[model samples]
Target: MTVVTPVAARVTEGRSLTWRVSLSEAADADMSTMFVVVPATAPGLSTKDVPARWPRDTAGAKPDPERPLSKVDGLYLFVDVPAGRTSADVTLPTLGDRVAEPAEPVRFRQTDMDTGEPLPDGLVLSGSVLDAS
Candidate 1:
């Protein structure tokens, strides 16, 4: 099981996150896991590494208040599933390692976060859609 930072009623963009991720087996079937700090926030990096710095207004329209203004920076891990690429289990410390809010699932057929293009072959993971929270 994963402990995700529950999405807030009004989570703002540019907010920072802390997180850690591992396999369910690593938890020994128990979800009481501790958090490892996110590496991107550590020293020796330039401003380019910041997630909050990702462009938000490039679409020529104000961002939907519910959408992320930048690439969300959070703690995450990839778990090996059978015969496929790793699936990301993201952990957000800003919200206590809870998953994105609204807890809604989305398919990649939805609009792209970047150019608003229809995501080709879209999101295959639970995180593809974020909650309205």
Candidate 2:
């Protein structure tokens, strides 16, 4: 199982997330091939929007990486936010299907990228979705 630890929330263009991800259950799984579930409305804030100073090799820094963003069924985004380097622009693209009324505040679910299934444990991170529009 994978656990998500949301560190902080900030607003740049939209909701930005600084979180730590790890595997709670050790398995022959690829960390790179994982997905984080996010609100469908915030795809723009993925790794594509982080500033240069972000994710520096500092003491508090997590192993963050620039990941590709894609929509899943239009209700949520299967985001590829890597673990460790702890910073990401949590904005999502407004494409495809959408929830009529998304629940608040924001939340994340760790899942297998290949199977699109949850990590088979209580791996969740729930927090506010700061909107700096």
Candidate 3:
């Protein structure tokens, strides 16, 4: 099972969602794995943005220029976490600010990198748009 938690309410704001993520266990399924999913209905968020520094290795290796995070199911952003890594500070790209509306919370799910399995209930990360600009 995987666990996802928001470090703070303000996880930085830009063209996408940038925040730190901690994994109870490393996800070592394959070269390409699905670590998280941000739904389109996640309240004012878009998954069309290009992912930044994706396909990264937690050991400080350069990001894989070939592999990148992309939209799936038309609206969900499937984030890829490196295999064999337990934690990372991740920055996922988005077309618009995740917090398009004030005070509303943006939500995301932690999933098995390879199987696309969501974590158990009550393990999602959520926060408001502290800095939409």
For TM-score, the strongest prediction is: 3
What is the alpha-carbon lDDT of model 3 when measured against the actual structure?
0.44
lDDT: the better of candidates 1 and 2:
2
Model 3: which residue pairs collide? Answer: 34-113
lDDT per residue for candidate 1 within 28-108, as digits (tens), equals 232322121122221211122223222222223232333432322222222222222222243221222233443222111
Q: Candidates 1 and 3: which is better by lDDT?
A: 3
Rank ordering of all candidates by TM-score, starting from the highest? 3, 2, 1
**Span of 10 residues, lowest total lDDT, candidate 3:** 66-75
How well is each residue in 86-120 modelled by candidate 3, as lDDT tens digits?
66554444334444445334555655555566656
C-alpha displacement of 131 in model 1, angstroms?
9.0
- Which has the higher TM-score value, candidate number 1 or candidate number 3? 3
- lDDT scores in order: 0.27, 0.40, 0.44
Worst 10 residues of 1 by lDDT: 36-45
Instruction: Tell how far residue 53 is off in model 2, in angstroms.
Output: 22
- The TM-scores, one per candidate, come to 0.19, 0.38, 0.42
Instruction: Quote the positional error of residue 15 for candidate 1 in Å.
Output: 10
